[model samples]
Target: MGRTVRVIAALGLAVLPGTTAHAAAQAARPPRAVAPALTAPAAPALRRSAWTGTWEAAPSGTAPALPGAAIRNVVHLSTGGNAVRVRLSNRLGTAPLRLGAVTVALRRAAGPDAAPGTLRTATFHGAPTITVAPGRDLLTDPVPLPVRAGADLLVTVHTPDDDGPATFHRQAMQTSYVARSGAGAAQDESGAAYTATTGSWYYVTGVDVRGSATGSVAAFGDSLTDGVGATTDADRRWPDRLAEHLRVRRVGVLNAGISGNRLLRDGTGPSGLSRLDADALDRAGVRVLVVFEGINDIINTPGPTATALTDAYRTLVARAHARGIPVVGVTLTPYRGHRLFDAAREALRQQVNTFIRTGGAFDAVADADAALRDPADPQRLLPGYDQGDHLHFNDTGLLAVADTVGRVLDHRFVGRAAGVRVLR
Candidate 1:
């Protein structure tokens, strides 16, 4: 039974111990010992949350920008911890990228309908000045950033020099910026601070919030997952959309995608098989994972035999399962044109899809093929959803993907809530 206590502020009468006298008994007995005062529990100690998120920028050498394109999409991360670490990327840049200044701050919301709050103040985890070579990424030093989860974390970067096309994602999933008033504006103002000004290269790659070592989700995949053709400044990629979904559910989504990334040999970007440690398996407290990849492996150059590709996928599955993380296999979407389609590629794709769908290795499967494929011609991608390359999905198409996955995930979340399932 639980304990209960009641306090009386003022009582005029008190029952007598022996007789029924009230006033006489009140002045007779010794006063009872006053109880000790209660105090509130202490706040949790400052600690970094294992930050895991991906880079979002428009990659150059693509078609025109889509609707809602911007200079950057700033993601005010849910902060919690003593120190913070930021991951910046030039993964899609064609040349070297430079940074004028970078900073983090406490954000202030302009209004309820507006973005999160503006930066009340900030601190740097490393030198404000840094540079990233083309096709590379940078991780900032562990800076003391005392914050709690659900708090806003503002990051800003400026590029004075850039070369090549200055690689960027088409539509990013998270928010990033190109700088307007240095890197420390009280609020991220509307309108880009920088124009499409000619320069060497500039882009924000990744950011993480570390608060105690726990809970992370790897946003694993290829160009689509990498936000290849999303939009400059506008973080509207599928993975970002997925991240948004996860955010509502209070789950962390770490994007581990590299543009043109394949599950087999190096193709558009890094291969998935080789980057597992750095991408997914290495993060702390990562309890769940989503593997939405293998399209490039099935369709890219120097194509592998069906047997080889099958073997590669099986290996990836085994590796993931070995770590005890529940892996959700996402089917490779339809890619029938834009120059990379072939009979051999089709065979490999089919074999890989078969494995993804039927393989008992995966904890669950996300059928992107069904979501994006044409109902009339299931093998071909649905019209309007395709980015016209037959390889990637447009923003609408990406949203469709997230919606489908979210639909599937809904059941899992509901089951867990109902005590029918458990995620450990």
Candidate 2:
């Protein structure tokens, strides 16, 4: 009874106004315990992504200036990634090229219009604009836009000042739009402001994706690889067909072909030897190189001899080997009726083709000749394959070339990356 009375007295002191009474009651009470702080759960590890080349156009040369105009280049991609980025070149520019705005968006029905919500403004090191120096190039910072394979994307470049000799790919074989008024129409989602069309690609050269693609295959060659005879806007280039075939492998195909390109020396663009590094070996995730050159060299006079050509092939292979990249030697295809065809040229072409097939100078060979040649004539393109030029191949012929490459690559490098080469 006395203890209960003491407890009641202590409770009464706690309620009292005086600090002395409160202190006495507090001192009499047991100590309170502290609760442990709550800990946050650990975060999951981020998935790693690699930059892969899904689409590319090697800069061929320069075009006239397009000052204060926004040029929208429509590019068809081979593969896709989680995010996207683009490469613009000034490789042939005589002066600095200043870009006011660089934007990308999904195309709406093959026009300059962007899909409802896919426009993305690309920055250069966090700045929305960039100035590329002469004989130089720039890559945009990655945009957080998920892209898909086989998408037709619009990469628009707004040049505030004269930006030419604009680094360009001469034979785009696809339609692109231009807004001749000013830079304000660059990011415009509607196609209203774009009133002009072109058959070449300017400023933008390559499209890279942040995704799981292992690497890319570069189709380095001439008009055959550049789709000279294939229908424009149809994506019927042999390289394009090759991309569709490569979709399952999660690999990309980059067409580095320039129409009239040659093997030993420069003509339409830099010779295969001159541009190999930039066009193939140094490209993003380039695991293999497929050279489909030599046709123009054979057609054009002052051409290399069979020995000189094969020796050049040896040099190209050696250089590619230096970079740990294997080379594939494609046999030179037949050209019997073209204006430049002659007995000597035909014999020389035969010698080169023979070497390509058995010289063992390359890591692998994709016999575009066997696939494109007339079994009946052996010295001419199969009639259906020929684009009436006896040299260039039509869409069906492009598919044939693509199939030949696909077959050899599949056999030699299925589930892996090996070199590829094509002859046209």
Candidate 3:
């Protein structure tokens, strides 16, 4: 008789063709298999911390004292974030600066007080008050205040001590409120306490926010970048416009422009070279630099030579590159009709612009000259864009410059944000 064949199936079962005993024996036997070990999922990569400068003004020097008063500064934010911090500068103060209290809030349409229920107090190292030494800057503790892009923020500071010669940004463009001689106005919600208005920003230099932006672009220049001719309280400065344009992307714009600032020597403020660290590289999350200066050095008192200007440009580029920040050079706009402009100055401007355009020293170029120059006379600004003084740009001209810069930055950064970090 043929022996009955039994086969073990892949399902751990024994198949018996003709014997019931085999089936019973297979069913009685225990299976010899072990369960596979499970592993904890790999830890997720740590999220990088990024700080974007939502609003900024280059500190020039001290303004009239705000002795024992509460000052409310209205600032326009370029980008929004989940949290916020304020940067107060005593960079030009001759005495110790005492901040009794500081608060930040979202404004309600040009008003002195913040929007109802949006006020948040700021602290330093967990303290409600802090003192900043002369020539120093202090950053407040992060406040959980969600902000929107292009929103207005009111930063109110109460100084109980005599803040002699208040360190300030002379051309704020936006109006701020001062409670001449009062405290606790910072916590006022009705704006009834604020009585005086001023165009300059005192003590407060920058507003930074914790964000996910790829980086920030520092606009380094002079009066033009400072929005000299732009309409007051309009936020029409070229850098402001550029910041508005960049709202959709992951970038921030910091205007480090000081009126009458020079590139090689001190004038209205510290020279561009001297302040580069504090104004550009040291700013939180700065990844790209836009150099629109040197025009003052070429046209103002003690004007520098074209060679000197270009050499400075080279140095600026080198310095930025050393920090892995790409530098973009903006060609100087025309100034043929200004009192300081002459054939020699115009020639020097052309030479410096040529170097900016073709020198290959900068990572990129923004042809602001071509964008604002009159078609009929390339050496002069277009009448429609000029602010009557050929040296400065009106609202329309500022918009044009902003558009050109936006295009350049968008092309180089928006879609290729990863590449921006890799730029040397």
lDDT of 3 by residue, 1-424 (tens): 2224333232222221212232233222332221111211111121235677777887887787777788899998887888999988877787878888899999987779789999988987677787676666667878999888888999998889776778899988889998966577888876888889988998898888885654677999999999999999999999999988877664678999999898877668777876776677667777678999988888877778887787777777766665666777899999988899898888999899988888777767899999999999998999999999888999999999999988877666445444433111
Model 1, runs deviating above 4 Å: 1-84, 88-101, 106-154, 157-204, 210-214, 229-234, 412-424
Q: Model 1: per-residue lDDT, tens digit, 57-169?
A: 22222222212222333543432456665555554555665555555554444211113333222222334565555555456666666655455455545555434454444
For candidate 2, which ten residues in a row score worst on lDDT?
Answer: 34-43
Which residue pairs overlap in candidate 2's backbone? 290-420, 292-422
Q: Candidate 3 — which residues are off by over 4 angstroms?
A: 1-49, 416-424
* Error of model 1, residue 423, in angstroms: 5.3
List, in order, the clash count of every candidate structure.
Answer: 45, 2, 0
Could you list the CA RMSD of all candidates, in the order they appear?
Answer: 20.7, 23.1, 22.3
- In model 3, pairs of residues that clash are none
Cα lDDT computed for each candidate against the true fold: 0.52, 0.77, 0.78
For candidate 2, the clash count comes to 2
**TM-score for every candidate vs. truth?**
0.63, 0.86, 0.86
TM-score between model 2 and native: 0.86
Model 3 scores a TM of 0.86
Best by lDDT: 3
Model 3 lDDT-worst window of ten: 34-43
